[model samples]
Target: MSSFRLITEYSLWFILPALCVAGAYSWLLYSKKGPWSPLLNKILFSVRFILIFLLCFLLIGPLLQYIKNEFEKPIFVFAIDDSESNTISTGVAKLSALKKEIEQAKKILQQEDYTVDIVTLSGKLSIDDITFKNPSTNLDYLLDKVESNYENRNLAGTILFSDGIYNQGLSPAYKELGFPLYTIGLGDTAAKKDIILKNILYNKLTYQGNSFPIVAEIQNQGFEGKDITVIIKNKGKLLDKKIITFSRNYDLKEVEFRLTSDEKGLQHYEIEVVPLEGEFTDKNNTGHAYIDVIEGKEEILLVASSPHPDIKAIKSVTDQKENYSLNIYIPGITEFKNEKYDLIIFHQIPDLQNTAAEILNKYGKDNSSIWYITGNKVNYASFNQINNALKISQRGQQLDQVTAVYNPDFNKFSLTTEEASVISKYPPVSVPFGEFKPMNNAEVILFQRLGNVQTVKPLLLFSNANDKKVAVFSGEGLWEWRLLEFKETGTTKVFDKLIGNLIQLLSSREEKRKFKVYPINSEFYSSDPVLFETEVYNDIYEKIYGQNINLTVTSEKNEKKHYSYVNTENSRFEIKGLSQGIYKYVASTILNGKKETSEGEFLIKELNIELINGTSDFDLLRTISDKNKGVFLPVTKLSSLPEILKNSSPQSIIHSNEELSEIINLKWVFFLLISLVTLEWFFRKFKGGY
Candidate 1:
């Protein structure tokens, strides 16, 4: 187990000369008139020769090699699946038995001189404080933990116990753990009698006073000649209910119902299936959904100098949207008294005759966003005075037809690659001959193209400044662009989406609230973190921290929990490990001697992966065990793990390390050389021969 060697990279021919020099020095020092005995003289000459030999050998830079042995005990990783799936009645009763089996296995492995590490697998992997309350199961996450924690150690093998029903992530079978595995199968393999509410389909947004549809997928087994009632409710009030009749023992049904959205803001709804007489589990009989209802029909007003085909083209797009109402007017001839529209369109207005100067000046700085379209009739000096978005220096009154070139860097919103490609090839639009100069704050969505030449002119510009949002299109004849877009593509949906993005961007109002609280997700997969953000703005609309935001969560069981936290960066707060259920929360904070409160609801849905099929996949366990050169055992026979590992590969790893040492730098060598020279001197003086 241990050895030493002297080595050098030089040729062997130099060793003879080095020894001869050491012989000559020893004879000159000790062969002269010395009264010492022949044995003493031989000993002195030998020591002298050896010392001088080593001193000469230093020139060759000799190295000493030492080899040592290191003993490493075999490592065994034992992971327990501590997810909610194992908490069902079938697995719940076996908890004590599982613990006993694992304990016996651990004791036997330790007796075999193996290092054991136990871990728990769930939504997240942790130490072996096994709690079967994790709402989700991620088997690969546990394997990743084993790989990270046991790397660079004497890892011999791994043993796992689970039902083999993984949800929320990839299966652990595919992960290359690079070690043999021994799997113990858990959970029942026979199908259980259960009725499950599989999934729901509905829209998240709808108009108030209108009915929306909700659809549910229902799956049932072993429940023939039975009726299951599906009910929908809101705020503890029943909205709709229906009974489903099964035609066969195993049935799949789709049920649809309509409910009126009569309230604004976020509305919470619950959907449930009445539990059958002999169902396996009832925790999955209910689910939650939400909808947001808003006011109907955004009002859009279009003002122009006279009736043109462009007015009809713009109206065609807005008219198709059930949520938009379009009204038209000829600026000087029409009576435009109402200012309640969400957005105003100014086309060739504010001419030398001052057609819409008053309306344009009033809305240029206010909150109502405006869109401008320029043409030959738009008076340059008067238009600049009315809308401060863009300036134009006209060389003549002539109108030039130019095609559109889309800007890839425009950030107002996104346009699909196909739409951007199609719009770039559209027919030319009419623009007054001039140099179009947009302000610094403006973002150009499109630039002007003269034939094949693209120019740095604002064909379409958007700006938000002075608390106002404005969009200007320095051209007309968009009716031509619409026609060309339809010609290129079979449908106008692409063009419609382009126009819709513009309208949606312009119609959106900024949030000016001083106090706000929002959740990252209103619905979470059980075991997911429940997070909320809180913001308190001063009178100047800047966020300030150091205030306690008290949050209260009320469960459906009428249980209330209180929590208080102070806001940090970006006014954020998060809580984790919430179970599956519907709950309402209220956030309250004191601001400027006044208390403000906001309320909302969130739902944590259960990870129904285990419920998807109660039957365990023993074949999956067999495949994994066999693939890793391991064996599979039932939950009842896990006690033989230690004997199996004793006969496994790599019983005990004996590690070896090689270390190098310099002969010249060895302390013992230096001390021995000095002692030898001192001994010879003392002996010669004692004999009166020096």
Candidate 2:
């Protein structure tokens, strides 16, 4: 409803004078006797008098005020749980019928003058969104969202439809809500006979030739004194087996399997508790685990011309790792084997005699990576000739002491703040006094700090040439660094990390593929999209795009599915709607007239958690309604919700609004003034009163 009125700040007494002034002026003008009839004169006089009086009133600057009030009906929220668990106990046909009935109830509430909004866990407020296909449910999250979305609105209450089985978020029964709750519970509350593999525990990564443990938890219901065999297999090959007897109903047991990992890649294992008669579901009776096994320990060879403390320090750090075997050989004392190793460390080698010439020549051409640490006794000419990364020119056999300065621009590896800080303040090491120069391709990790100034000359650097990694250290006080760190912090962790990172970088092999595609993960759920990542590179190893790659996916039954990658994005390819199974895929692309292909396999496991334990918890729903000051009912009584909400006496809200404007600003007032002036002029001219 709205109303309008005119008001003025000036007093009403000011209007009386304006009225007298207008009447006197109009009577004087029209009282003249110039060629006019008396009747016409009186009529013209009244029009002029009224027009003049209205114009005089404009000086007061009156305002027009308007007030409006709006009434909004109370809103009722109907939230539904759209999860797969709802379809477990309630079949599809019944669920569909129930959904139609809920829609009818919405129409009834709207007819009764109450606003009804239908919402689901997906946040879409449409009846079609209740498909009962969402993988999980969270009742507490739904309640929180409704309260937040309609905080200050005229929300009378909420009507929720759920199965009381939430597996994603906190339980709704324990939460305190702001509005009254009416719950319509669905699903069966009685327990069913089922055998479920509750959980699996194992390491995702381990080394080959090492034994790892796999523990599986099993739960059984209504199967007392029943014997079952739990078997573990890999690619249909049985590795271990165990027998268990359920002592009572609802018995839970754990079976452990210790088996050696013999492969060097991702290994998929299947754990099954043999199904019995009359089971709720066979999907949860079997569990799967994928473990990636890395190749055995890496071999490292340390060669030196004489006994040095640096060799001992390097050996101590490497010895602590089970995946690394370190060997030290002093030229004249222990015989050095020329066998191939993952990494070779030359400590002040290529001395005055250049004794390591044979060893360097042998492994230099092989796949073994090399690291060089120079001391005072190292022959500068021999050192410069061995590695192309760094070159040094000694000045009359002199040695200089220098400290380390970290280079932040280095991208070959990373270091912690504490490690970089402690190493920068370390005691100076002895380096040959000379002109030091590194190649353009060398990546410097540490620069030399000369007394008070830091120089661009590299103290430690690495380079890759012909797919071989080479590192050079220009100083030789590594042992002192370890001791200083241990002295200050009672541990040499900082020192060890610095060395470990360098070794790991040089020892690891670089991938030589110019184009490849692989699965985003080793395992995926049946509901999840099977995604693969694709990468293409030029001859120089820079990223390239706009290439088409074809894929062929083969299932265990020899069924084939073919697809081609779309280059909308440079790195990701997605495939959806695949059932649970093990699949092998091959991706191939042609570049530079050569065919390159990548092959891999992935496992899609079952995620039908709703069928694992189809029992509902209606007691939780009752508790929620009781605590929130409402009533609970089975889904059969859903139509009676409208009557219950009416008893709560939901009232509509009235919102009032007011607006003010000057009367003179009204468009009709301006048009009226023009019309009165025009009429007066026409009548005066026709009657010859001008």
Candidate 3:
């Protein structure tokens, strides 16, 4: 039972002031009557006596009624947290026990004539309902609701059941509710012994033959000072492996590996750390990455009406370092066989003879990539017999003099929507060009207008029809860029990058049967299993099977992961995940138990931390309970909580009551009277109140 007091007890102090005033009034009347007062004095004394009687009546604070009901009953409230994190380990069992205890306590409170309220902490609010079903746990939300709803009700105490893992709510301990908190902790306190791949970092895009870095983070618990091996493989071939030690307790270790693009198109890389002994799940031990590689080297056929510096300049740029191979065909002299190149560039071919027109048509039909460069000598008549596919006008005109303009700003050309996919990175600028329209299947890569000429033509274009690709340059001034700007460097790096990019774009043919493998990281352990898988795609993007594929996995430590393909009824080819060390894998189809291979390679990374100490530390629970004035009970003692709870009581409510006369002192009234007298005196002297 809680204690209570009444306001009437504080009114006793008013009696002294009333008696003083009455006595002073009686004395004053007697003194004014010269100590011989008669009826008038007696009447004044009687009035003082009545005033004293009234004052005493006011002093005796009254109450209509006063009652006290005392019993051993105590109200109890159970606030339970039912969040997702609470579902770990033996949480359900602990929660069940907590619920049973709450029910038992509710019965006890009811037997003692005390009210019990059950509040569930979840995504929403509830009262007196102990179903305790919620998708989330929010302790602060429940407390706020309780504070708002139960403000007038006298709460004896509160009990809390949770895992101490609060993500969506405020701290319940921070609220100053003047109540004792009894917390029941749920879930396992021990740190779990496990290994997890924390992260995998790699580039989104890579160029063919370029080396890219792959970084992996390995997090380990309970394993320290123990050597672990990580292995990497592609398809099934072992690429690399490394062995490393881990730190005590739980720590994150980083491993890096280098991956090279072997074939064009999309390349898939898988990196995995070998599973440690006594680890949880192996799913987190591996990660996957993908990159797109466009073919860079291309064979280009150049056909021109006359040999000029423009052709030489374009050839010089294409021929360096085997980026692109350029073949020259003069219009009248050479009757060329059209079988050798991916793209064919035409420079001012003036005559549309039957043989040349037929060749052009054949080139277009064969899907041979082509480029048409227009100059003063060329007219529509020269290209008209070729089915007018080039969109060239037929009127030929001779120019007296054409000045080459070297505009650095021509390199900043922006790509249209159609060209953005392939030509996204290159800046486009106006190049000097003559008149010509791109073919129906052609896309303009660069455009320019000739000396304020109303007709603007494509300076560079690509066509996809007939399996052919064509690039058209409508001017001859590009050669001057090399001489005026590049000098001995052939052309500026920007121009080189442009040519390199163009070659890459034109030569990119989706691989008919190709597979690429990459290791997530470079280092691996010999004891760790190497993971390798290939995403096989047909020429048209339909998934295909590499049945009975043989993958030869080799490790730097002489470990191997060779395996014959065991078809899993799927197109993907995979090998066993590996351990610490640098490893590689080469995958191929096996015929008669022999490796009849295509292509494959990969790398495996190692874990960095040692495994001396076990993962997890349970000291946090004790620390938290100690800091918050709560008891940290063991899991076994959870069922004996009712007795401890019954013993605990609500915090004492401390109040300091003062008498009314003490609060309303006469000194304030005396000061006021003195101020009024001074004001009256000042008014009499100066006609103003002070």
Per-model TM against the reference: 0.73, 0.71, 0.34
Q: Assess candidate 1 and give its TM-score to the true structure.
A: 0.73
Predicted candidate 3 versus true structure: per-residue lDDT over 1-690, tens digit per residue: 333444444475666776777677667745554333366456546555555545454456532223344333355666666654554433446566756665766676566555667777643333334433443455678667666766655666566666655545666545555454556666666676667666778776666888888777777777788776666666566667767688666778888878786777555566778887887446457765555565654667777766688777777777664446667777667656656677776676544343355556666556555556666555556454543345665333533223222223343233334333223223233332334555665665554434444233555555555445555555555665555545544545555555656666666664444444434433334334444455444446554564555667775556776677544433444345565334456776544354344554444443322121222223434444455455666545665665675556433333334333421234664465455445434433463211
**Candidate 1 lDDT:** 0.79
- Candidate 1 residues 530-587, lDDT tens each? 8898888999888788888999987777788889998777645877767756778999
Clashing pairs in 1: none
Pick the winner on lDDT between candidates 2 and 3.
2
The candidate maximizing lDDT is 2
Q: How far out, in Å, is residue 283 in model 2? A: 3.7
Error of model 2, residue 488, in angstroms: 20
Candidate 1 vs candidate 2: the TM-score winner is 1
Candidate 3 deviant stretches above 4 angstroms: 1-194, 199-222, 233-241, 247-271, 278-282, 289-339, 346-367, 375-388, 391-471, 475-690
lDDT of 2 by residue, 178-245 (tens): 88898998878888887888888998777989999999999888887888889999878898899888
